[model samples]
Target chain A: MSGLILDFEKPIYELERQIDEMRNFAVTENIGALNEEIQRLEKKLARLRENIYADLTRWQRVQIARHPDRPHTLDYIAGMMTDFVELHGDRAFGDDKAMVAGMAKLDGMPVMVIGHQKGSDTKENLMRNFGMAGPEGYRKALRIVKLAEKFEMPVLAFIDTPGAYPGAGAEERGQADAIARVIYEMGRLTVPIIVTVIGEGGSGGALGIGVGDRVLMMENAWYTTITPEACSTILWKDQEKAAARKTDCAEALRLTAADLLELGVIDGIVEEPLGGAHHDFSAANQALKTAISESFAEITSTPIDTLILERIDKFSNMGVYDVVPADPV
Target chain B: MSWFKKPNSGPKKGDGDRRNIPEGLWIKCDKCDAILFKEDLDRGFRVCSKCGFHFKIGHQKYLSILLDEGSFEERETELRTTDPLQFKEKQNYPDHIKNYQKRSGLTEAVITGKGAIDGRLVSVAIHDPSFIAGSMGSVVGEKIARAIRRSIELRCPLIIISTAGGARMQEGILSLMQMAKTAIWLTRLSEAKLPYISLLTNPTMAGVMASYASLGDFTLAEPGAMIGFTGPRVIEQTIRATLPEGFQTAEFFYERGFVDQVIPRPELKETISRILSYFPDQSMSPESAEEGV
Candidate 1:
């Protein structure tokens, strides 16, 4: 398997597939010319892949956000943080695996790390509920954040959910109330809060724990209000017509990290590897660790009350727009 | 990610057997197919007398029904949406705003005001669903946030009635940002020990349902209202399956424990007034709160 290749990566993968066959033949037949050609083909394949991923459109960035090999919450913790102790349950309800929270040390700095966990494969995804957190997941995160606040520790939240689960039990359990409570709590919490949109940051599911002193996004990640497919159906309607207009829907959603930064919704975008964070897990982790420390330093220096008031102001001031006096013809 | 035990999922509740009356200025109850007269329905606050299918009511009716006589003084009528998006598709957002303004005669989707409910001062925000489906745009969120802040300043209870499809997509991401903006105020209200009563009406879904509307200290809803994050139409298309009957109704939520009480329209004012009396300052003076823990 090529590890969940996108439509745009077909040409590069085709070359890589051919190069693999040629390399095997060269090894068996002991041909120098064949090995030389294989190396050249591999170089060409790498360049092609880099070029395609460089200036991707909104839809392409969305695809990268869901790449199967993308490092998830557990992967990041393993690579960077130490002394991680997993926490479980919301106390009011059973444990929800979609959102995982625990105490961890970042370079020996004690902090609470909370994140949405999407599984690497089908079974794991099933267990993690594809990172579409239910009410309990949000409540569990809230509990950990509250605990961190009691001890005056910083909070580092990683958002990567598709959206809140819209199932029978989730609704019954007050999914919306749970999400609203998390955002409400994070805004007024006395301790420093830092949030990174590591993957798909879909709707309120992402915003449930998204408020922070400084909100961040990965270079290849997206933070759209609604998914492109959902937007397409809502704005353009169903069937052949909607499929044609989905790219337009993606553009309209303003979901890209660059777009969010321009809109003043996000503070900064962390640079990812050439293809994406999925291409180099350890390096991606390093970048994330450095970014969090830098943000935390800037945020924690402020007084607690000002930090809380400013955090609320930052979110409240996001959506003010002036009505144009006249329509642009 | 179906992370739930199956909730109360049977046919529509409270829409039990009904008697048919002869039709004149007649409207058919969509839930129970009972022929209802327009005049009789109005007398019952637009609920079908026979089956209890609550017809949608706008902000005007809500202010009158819930508030003490002529007590509501609408706040922030001057706050208008800048149409910051200058968003256009089938029609420009400004043009759409003008049409809705003329049609609804309101500054925003929700009407925020301070009024006496059973002689107790409370901040109220009632949404008009007919105005662009009562989608929460920037102004809608701003007014609600300010209203809650006003309640905090006044040190009184707050009531918000919500009925919406979701965030206004025309405003783009800014519309979605309104959800967090409004919820920020709810936390402030909670911190200050102010009570918030969220009243969900018919068709409360999407961003509106996910924000302050769902976080009320004493959450309540009208009978047969659909209250959820995603609407059934979207879920049906996504999952490609027919939903069980009574999917997102208030009765369903009451069974699932999302809603505290499912009151009919006539009993709403009495229930809200009763809940308002429970607040510490409502029964006692502000000086009394300062005197004790």
Candidate 2:
């Protein structure tokens, strides 16, 4: 954990801090009374945490979604997959660091694992473009997804990105085309595809690999069409005001996992630990692994001819009121 | 609302070209300083006669310009915005919807349906930037998706003329979900061997450009249109560097082979008709409307 505390989490942080100090004192001095106090404080801290996290506003969830300790794609792959051999480059262009895709085995089922990996620090964020994949990154994903199609492996996408890299080079190389192409090709794939929104799901960057049979979001994650800051800028028409108005925008956007689930934007909300997925990596991984397998079990049983159609229907069903009659096509 | 502002509303002298001058009906051209007569401008498809500056037209205007006489039948027009988020900023999203609906006489940004271009029936969806900056929402996404599905069902070609800022802000993530959803339907169109002609008008930026708008089998753009995933100024600011002239224009995209062709507004109808002729309907007109149908 970052040990950094949000404003709302200040009380919990202080309680936990005292518990840690008392534990250290108990171990160092062989004290029994302080140990008992530490246990009581721990229980209080857990209750406080549960109370606080159960009802976070959309803005607070956004903060947690972007927490540095939130498990990155590389961490999940290393901790969750087996025999993961990362195959690189789009072949038409150079390899992109932001999007890391490769072949892997998930619970004895071979699948193409792809995800947007963000960096932990300034240096790494620069290297990874803050998890914003450029055109080459998407092209590389397309190349590997095509490979997965050839090998008949189910695809798993771990979505976490602020957006597609908005650099000039990315645009020049046709970032739009690359993202559109991936969604297009993947939409037609016969094999089962599952997407897990482990963190921020921003715009087309997330949708680059977001189209699938079943899509899930972590409890603390926020998925939106645009960042709250961007939304504020658009609505208020002032750059400085956007920063100040982001909380209102965040609340207005309905981007929290709970909101998205109710809106029919996400199929499921994967449970994160009370402190968020960052606090309990083991529990988070186990939950993700279970979600993946359960999703796979549901989709993998469908006949080949109906799989692509069902995938189409899954996305087609999510939206406002249907104009056409509910009669089957 | 600014257009309704009286430009020459001061006390008028009787002999000052006031004869049928049509008071409160003049607009200054953004490109040229000359004031234009609103009627004359509308007659010219909203293009500046002197400087050739193309004004952004509404989706209904596009339908009238591109489709054959009395041939357009819009589908799913009842799929109105539910404002699922109940988002409010300067005003609530429902008020914004009410205001735009009153102003534009349209429920949403997109108008999708069937129309015949040069005797060839095609599925059509034209996005109006005036309605919420043509931002994609769940309603817009669902309409476009159904449009593609209609094309698949009718075994006809599909065309979507996009002029958008990006995804709708009020509807939030549901707006962004439209990107994947629209692209999903287009893939279905392609898989079924239906052709999609993506027509990008001025300022197709962000999510719309990054999704179905860029995935067309044949992508066409209006000349001088800004067609990119991000605004050029934004990219320049991020990189802290000056960009080349005409960086994100349709011509720039043409050079990169991202856009198939950049057709001028005046020629758009003719160009689309020519393309529609290429995929002839075997049931009608024997040899198809080959050249200028």
Candidate 3:
């Protein structure tokens, strides 16, 4: 957090550093008069934080969402669930570390939890493929979700991926086929599903486990069909402005949590800490836990068939279009 | 209909080879680079006779190539794409859509309707790649959704010829959600036990590939089609290395057990018709295909 201050957050951090210095000086030099100065600076810091956090642009929110200190799927799982039993492998292939799936007790209720897992460091990121799952990862997710359906347990999927891995191996092993199977099966799965975008929900990788009765996103999460950089490159090959227009591309994509909610893409947003989920992990975890619990409480009581029907209806009614008339027969 | 008609005249006596071929009479194959007569190519269903390269034909040509003459009654032709994200680059999203619409002579990327193959009634949705790369947006999603529902209602076999660059960039999340939307409707189609033949053409990628395009009962592909979740350029950028040849091609997918078969263009209609013959309908046969023998 100290090392990775964003450009907009420099002023707030400088104020905070000044207050810390004043407090240290007062304690060392027996200068009690500095308390008033420290308090005044603290107030200014609070106001600055509020102003910056409240008016964060879509691109800034994307930065916060991608902050290295930001909590990952495993963090939320460890903080919120109990009696976790980790499952592994897609049966036909080796286990994929990028996607974590297993049985866990969510507030004493039996549930199957699955999520895309990114890493905290370079070595672990390499191991996790930066949370961009390959074909096996999606296949493993499908297996776990299918198991949940068989066991009549509610499925909680944490989506946090930049996108599926765009590699030769992923393509060779049928990345599209695996993802398509998951979406196809999950659409009609009898068990209840609640998907929450914990970080970055990018394209079909997220949608592989994203179709749920209640699709949610954390406050800072940005979900999109393609990342802004990719979008900018594709839309504006003008080389010079492609880098500059990346922020505009993010805004144009309408990928923020609030934007998605407004667009009716996501069901609701779970609030994060003032700065972001990374600043206060406990508060972020608590908010996510409450959101999941509340969504489960609302959906768990519905009959399975009705739940399945409503889930299908929820996705079926998502696109915006119009029908005027068919061709003359 | 116009393309189906033979050219009123033939090519001139002089052959120009690669340097100066007559523009309208001769066409070059993208794969083989062999000069081909337009009439011969059209007569072969756009499959190059020299090298057997399957050219990406328009959806109208696909309708004529697959469906029986005068048997197609197009449905959901009026569905239109809205600029949900208000996306703009050099041009406004709606204006770009209008440009593609005007150039491709299509209201949207795909055309959904009921058509006949070998006199077998079938529901079909053919994608035209010339229209915005046949990107899937809200309109394409709704039309395909309606097509699936119509198939279930009519209890006819469904055929969706997919040729897309995946989800539309202009529509953003709405375009992405169309994957799940189409997948959900496809699941409903499967539950109805109606056979779905997803015919993959050149350049199917990303969102569309990860949804309805890959969920077909008989997932067929035209020869040498590029079918994958991510395109080669993106994969090359991601991996930061040169790709092995034949990656994500139809033959590559077939080797990997994803594609059931890679049929040539000339035999596509016969292949689909032969497959449809196996499942007439539930009403026609008391024992549905879903029930195990």
* Best candidate, lDDT: 3
Give candidate 1's error at residue B259 in angstroms.
Answer: 2.6
In model 1, how well does chain A match by TM-score?
Answer: 0.93
The local distance difference test score of model 2 is 0.82
In angstroms, how far off is B146's CA in candidate 3? Answer: 0.9
Better of 2 and 3 by DockQ: 3
lDDT of 1 by residue, B219-253 (tens): 89998888998778766765678889988889888
The list of candidate 3 runs beyond 4 A from truth reads A1-3, A238-240, A325-329, B1-22, B281-293
Work out the TM-score per prediction.
0.87, 0.90, 0.93
For A112-144, candidate 1 gives per-residue lDDT tens digits of: 989999999898999999999999999999999
Clashes (candidate 2): 0
CAPRI band of model 2?
Answer: acceptable
- The sequence of per-residue lDDT tens digits that candidate 2 reaches over residues B44-77 is 6767788876666777668778888787776776
- Of candidates 3 and 1, the better by DockQ: 3
Q: List the global CA lDDT of all models.
A: 0.81, 0.82, 0.85
- Per-model chain B TM-scores are 0.86, 0.84, 0.87
Reference-based lDDT, residue B16, model 3: 14
Clashing pairs in 2: none
